[model samples]
Target: MNILVTGATGFVGRRVCARLQKSQSYNLSSAVRQSGSNPPGSEVVIHEVDGQTSWQCALKNQQVVIHTAARAHIMNDEVADPLAEYRRVNVDGTLNLARQAAEAGVRRLIYISSVKVNGEQTPAGCPFTAEDAAAPADPYGVSKLESEMQLRQLAKDTGMEVVIIRPSLVYGPGAKGNFATMVRLVAKGLPLPLGSIRNRRSLLALDNLVDLIVTCISHPNAANQTFLAADGEDLSTTELLRGVANAMGIPSRLIPVPAGLLQFGATLLGQKALARRLLGSLQVDIEHTRKCLNWTPPLTVEQGLRHCFEIRQD
Candidate 1:
């Protein structure tokens, strides 16, 4: 099979390329903005162009096109017109790539979407499922949802298979984002007052997410389906932090601050938005994915945490 991977130079994309390389017997084409940081061991045909034009040529004769590229979340984009930019890249560019892939007779287009597309936080006792109404809270999430809609339309029009994988809070070695920041904060022996929250949120390990993506690539059940993926278990902020501490071989110093007080303080400091998401319940019910794909995440929360700590130790 000939596969094309966009965002092949990114954290998850690099890992996926590496896995594809090791598995062998397939031709790999990687699209990147730059040429120097290609994934090791994969003899990737690197094409330098933006997503709109890049895929026009890079997707030729490809059996599967994994669209992992996107305008990733940025905390500093607080006041910017996030919707416009996000739509341009995440929605428009995604459609362009999908169109090219369909035109090139690509069979499957696996899109790596964010779980945020199913609303920022699922209601208490009402875990999110693939059939849930997609109410994206942020511009980034909205963009992803819009792109998924476009992919569905393209699939209907061209008869190309579209598979969507929504992963929650993915973290592991070399992961850079909010999760990485949390790991660093815990590693520094900082006292965090997150123990009071009793919310459960699902997470994705790099290894588990990679495995799931590979499964989705060829699994007969994954065709024309959207799946939410996680480690199959939920962990509270306290549990996650404690696990991180354990992984780092350090004692957790979690304090039990009142949630109201924390919110009040954050409001006073103009960071309430940040505090709520950090200490909120973002659970997802991935039962459909497991049942349909007949897949289970091999890594537990503890194991994933340990792997992150092990790799981050330098």
Candidate 2:
């Protein structure tokens, strides 16, 4: 099949392209803003993903589009209108591509979305499901939700298949954001106050997420369906820290500070958002995805963490 993968330069996108290249079943091409970033000989320069960016040359004769491009989450963005910026790139750009893909006779478009579309947190024993009402808390999440809605409507009108996969925090070697920071701290053997944080969070291994995207590429059940991706096991803050430390073959120097005190300090220091992410209970239920697609994460949480560190040591 002829396939076009967007955002081929990103972390997840890069991995997807590599995995697809290994398969003889696909004639792989990648969309990028720059040259020499994708696989050698399959790069299509589609400048920026926006409402006006043209995808005609790239979409010609392509059967599937795995869109992984988006304006990713920003920690402390100082922009005047963050929501507008996010919408312009995430929502507008995504819909633009989908419309053009449908016009070009693209059969399927698998969009890589975020679990943030389900909201910020879930109570204990309660996880966000694909069927839950969208409750995006931030501009990025809102834009993703908007893109998903637009894609669903476009699918309904154009007779195209749209598969949306919402994944929780994704981490592996070279991961950024909170997971990276935690890894650095654990490597240094610094004492962490997250030992007492009892909140569970869902996480997706980079490889597992890539595997899911590949599976959905031709899975009949994935068409016009929304799936959540995760490692199936939820880990608490303490469990996560220890897991990393153990994987790194080091002692975990975690302090038993109460979660409340940690949050209070973070609030006073204008890091409330950071604290919530470190101590929040964000979980996702991928049961529907498993039942519908007959799939399972290829790695357990511990195995995933071990692989994450093993690559770093390499």
What local distance difference test score does each model get?
0.84, 0.93
User: To one decimal, what is the Cα RMSD in angstroms of model 1 from the true structure?
Assistant: 1.9
Task: Work out the TM-score per prediction.
Answer: 0.94, 0.97
Query: On a 0 to 1 TM-score scale, where does candidate 1 land against the true structure?
Result: 0.94
Q: Over the stretch 18-137, how does candidate 1's per-residue lDDT look in tens digits?
A: 888777766787777665764644334544333455555677678998888888877678646889888888898889888888988999999999998998886555788999989988
Candidate with top lDDT is: 2
Error of 1 at 68 (Å): 0.6
Tens-place lDDT per residue, model 2, 1-314, is 99999998888988899899988999999899987674633999988889999999999999999999999998778999999999999999999999999999999999999999999989978999999999999999999999999999999999999999999999988889888888899989888887788999999999999999999999999999999999999999899999989989999999999998998899999997888888889999999999999999999989999998898878
CA shift at 26, candidate 2, in angstroms?
0.8
Which residue pairs in model 2 clash with each other?
none
